[model samples]
Target chain A: MSEPIKTDVVIVGAGPIGLFAVFELGLLDMKCHLIDILDKIGGQCAELYPEKPIYDIPGIPFTSAQGLVDALLQQIKPFNPLYHLNEMVETVEKIGDPLFRVTTDQGKVFEAKIVVIAAGGGSFQPKRPPIPGIEAYEGKSVHYAVRKMESFRDKRVLVVGGGDSALDWTLNLAPIASHLTLLHRRSEFRAAPDSVNKMMALVGDGKIDLVVGQVTALSGGDGQISKAMVKTNDGSAFEIACDALLPFFGLTMKLGPVANWGFELKNNELIPVDSAAFETSIPGIFAIGDINWYPGKLKLILSGFHEAALMAQKAYRYVYPEKRLVFQYTTSSTSLQKKLGVAPERPAAPARAAT
Target chain B: MVQITFIDSRGTARTVEGEAGSTVMETAIKNGVPEIEAECGGACACSTCHVYIEEAWREKVGEPSPMEEDMLDFAYNVQPNSRLSCQIKVREDLDGLIVRTPDRQA
Candidate 1:
């Protein structure tokens, strides 16, 4: 038999929510193993639009996705959570009370006392456009985004899509690229008004070319993107020479291996979970984030935050029933200033009154 | 039909036949390839079907959509050549393509 590996918790997916779980679990002085499919952590916040501003998350007035990820990482830095990147979790089975057999595509197995299925919409896959010859130039000159801006320095680039991702990349690439072109099937952009306004300014100054048309064909030379054939709505066609092409179209989410785990699903898609604990029909297993479904659950980052905390608490109670949680306040001062150096001059007011 | 080869993390290579327009993920799963777990049924919502394209064939497989890129951030074992097999539609040009499965699947 293989040597048994054990931990307090195993968190799948390194996205913002997953990292948040690490933060919470750390606060409880628990050890955890964090895994992600990507080479790095941060999940959607790090991968999708790191620069895009997120306004809804509490506490911060406005923060970029990457910024939020950085802060959360800092919060959990002291816990020393173990991380396994570029690894996909294929199966999660409950072997006994609070014990799980987690297997991966690589055949490595991990046994943990508790499992948190924070896989988050499973593996994320992209949807490609049906443009003819688009696949002809994959690595040489065509890309999904200018992932690293330095690579596109002094090169002519073509960007497709009117959405936030496309527009954002275009604006970012405008200054570095030798020449930049933006193509969209429709004249109007789907990006935020601020981004659209920036693109308009760049177009007005001739820093970038905005072509209103759809890409019909892609031709490559020297194993890289060379020219693109675009057809306008008014029966006009043109070809633009380019060194690289980036398509910022969005991605779709797949259920991954969990789909076959035999959980009851609603609408033949989302996994049905308990309204309170977010547990699926399978005991000791829980689903959170966009992949879960219930009567009145709102699919948002904040809601996922709430779900993860509650799931952790319930899982903790199951694993260590003898442990009692205690909250200690050194003093009655509500604000930071009074708590630091001086005891409250008045007898501690009722805790409820302070609120 | 296009014949594509997939190398599991263990370096075992298996070839599968894919009909034109079917996704690489579909071809692998239909043939009982163990590496790809297309969790979202090819909707681009999940990154479970992630595969790394051979460097030589990277240019042949175009860039992923923004949605796919975003999803890829959530995938396991992502590489510069990483692409979601479900998002890649099989065609005659991709007949000799090779992809490698990550060491783990989410």
Candidate 2:
């Protein structure tokens, strides 16, 4: 247990919408602390589709998903939104009207006047394989993702799954591993055609072993896996010796602890929100982005942007009920411009324009 | 001002006034009509603002772009008259624009 970090707002999920919400809330003089499950910012943009191009953004003709996140990070830099990455929110308890305390899996607690759930499709987590006794080697010999390639150097590695992550890591770790094995449920793969071809090429070159079977058991001592039992599709089981296991079973979005917060849920899954303010059943808690459901709710980035704007309006009232709010545009409002660190347009410089 | 009629999931009709050049989705949100989710504002990246344009006004609304049509795949119970309201710009000629929302937008 530790002292909870205090802020004006606590935003869950550091996705594109959540990042934009920081700018809107900051413009209103509210400080924000953002919590995300991934180790980096930009949620799915960075984690899933950083290189993918996104169309339909209003201003720019086109931008990569990560490029959009980078621009947003630069836009909100002046706001100094604090980020708590690599942590998932575990509990959110409303202490008072418009006041709540949020705790993360890492034991960090945050207190804020408003809680904004910008979690896009909820938190993306690795789907664990149904191997018996696999939990013992979770952080030891078994890993869902590779953090350091050096860790696998000279070690016998076993890669699982049929997706891009599995094939990519298998290709990357093959050269360094003393012995590498790629195990999947079938010979066919769900990964990109190129990666699958490359993996087959590796297998053909005898650089690695490809086994079509399911890992059924783990055998190890001292929390380290030494061997895995694989059941082939032909109903034959065999033992494969390995020291490191990388399972890329893909990611599943779970509502996680947010589901237990007791807000009225729509579809027994998504949070029901009032279109007026994007507020949830709770007075202080608000749901935005893909986590919310309304009569015509569309899970798009721009829609989340609108929800964030309206949510901020009501949040401002909750944070400062006695203060009068004056809506102002960044273009004309000197105060807002100052907060954004923009100098007023001055006499044009001929040399600057020529360059 | 342009007048737009929005039918909710329950078949309730509400007529609201929208400023010229503003999106139909924007107008519905501004007027506190819950039928149009318009989650993406006017980005046209989502189909949450899907609406059925009246047969008489379908030609005026025009056909959806390929991208809008692609996004409509994610909408629930889409019809031939379905259009993403975010792409429909309010104008003087659309003074009597009539559209109805679907049962839900996934």
Candidate 3:
């Protein structure tokens, strides 16, 4: 119950749309604090396909996914928006007319006049490998993230996946675990060569066992796993006894806490918002980006930008009830340019040598 | 038009007309076939569109690319015949293609 950080707007999900919302809100003199479950901003663009080329953005004919995120970060630099990363918003309770108290899972709180949910595809959570009855051993024996290395001390550990997460954990825990096994579907690994070579060196030293197989089933009792039934490429099935299983299948976006926020959802997934202001059923709480659904909702970055501009217009009324709002363009209005920190306009790098 | 048959985990078979050169994932999504969640929208970045090619058509469907193979690491119940439906394009030569969705996608 720390003192809540008060702000004019609290934007959930620091994705492209949320980042743009900061610029829009900043232009209107509304300060924002963005919260995201990811440790870094850019959401899926950075995590899923940072190298993928995006061609749909207006004006910019070509830009990579990470390119857009970096540009957005640069565009909102003047706003100085506070970011609370590695935190998931737990609950949002309306305390006043157009005012809400937001609480994160990490116990950080915020009191704001507006709440924007630009959570594109929701939070990226570790994919739960669809093993039958694995849920029973989730917290007890099965885990996705390694919060404490000492927890696996002296316990037999099974690390799954061919990525860095698997190999890194395998190498880190091999010393402490009574026995360690690395199970992957194939012999080839997607992890870095250095880490893979180190893991192989460990296997060569008899410190860790490498198995080319996939876990199909788990047998256990009372929320503790006894053994996991594995199937190899040749269709042979075997069992591996272990006290811990760490399956790092990478991340998948899920409509996590957004579903519990009391907003009316269209398909148990997306929040139903008005096409005009992009506000949800609740006042002062708006949803943008792919997380929102309207009559003709198009889940695109350009569409999310349009939604942010309009949502900010409505958000201004909540943050500044008695003030008059006159929309001005950044190109023509000196006041807007002043807010952008280029009031007098800096000389343009000598016109690029007139090439 | 090429024809594709998709069988869900429960063994429910769905036959649909797929346009040649279009992706198998696009055909399933357009025809409203369930169990094919192309979360990345055919970018091959995600493994949600994972499917197992029928043994008879395994050779015709061809093996996965190196990139698809890497993404398959995130999929469930992956076998030698498994493929991401997004990477499989419809063709006239493969007039009768059959694929089965896994019990769950990653």
Instruction: Give each candidate's interface RMSD in Å.
Output: 12.5, 11.5, 0.9
* Colliding residue pairs in candidate 2: A302-B40, A303-B39, A303-B40
User: TM-score of candidate 2 restricted to chain B?
Assistant: 0.94
Task: State each candidate's chain A TM-score.
Answer: 0.59, 0.75, 0.95
- Candidate 3 lDDT, tens digit per residue, A1-355? 9998999999999999999999999999999999999989999998888889999999999999899999999999998999999999989999999789999989998999999998899888999997888999998999999999999999989999999999999989999999999999999999999999999999999889999999999998998898999999888999999999999999999888888999878889999999999999998999999999999899999999999999999999988889999989999899889889989857677555555
Question: For residues A1-355, what per-residue lDDT tens digits would candidate 2 score against the true structure?
Answer: 8898999999999999999999999999999999999879998788756776888788888999899999999999999999999899999998877689899989999889999999987887876666768889999999998989999999999998777789999999999999999997656676788999999999999999999877889999988999999888678999999999998765556677878999867776799999999998889788889889989998778899999989988899999999998999998998999899995877876765445
Q: Which parts of model 1 are misplaced by more than 4 Å?
A: A1-4, A126-251, A327-355, B1-106
A202-292: candidate 1 lDDT, tens digit per residue: 9999899999777788887666888899888676899989999887656645667777777877776688888688777876677777668
Q: By DockQ, is 1 or 3 better? A: 3
Report the lDDT tens digits of candidate 2 across residue range B12-97: 99999999988899998899987677644566654578889989999988998766765554454455688899888898999988
lDDT string, candidate 3, B1-106, tens digits: 9989999999999999999999999999999999989998888899989999999999988999989999999987788889999999899988989999987886
Each candidate's B-chain TM-score, in sequence, is 0.96, 0.94, 0.98
Task: Name the regions of candidate 2 deviating beyond 4 angstroms.
Answer: A130-237, A241-246, A345-355, B1-106
Interface RMSD of 1: 12.5
Report each candidate's C-alpha RMSD, comma-separated, in the order given: 16.1, 13.3, 4.8
What would you estimate as the lDDT of candidate 3?
A: 0.93
Local accuracy by lDDT, each model = 0.77, 0.86, 0.93
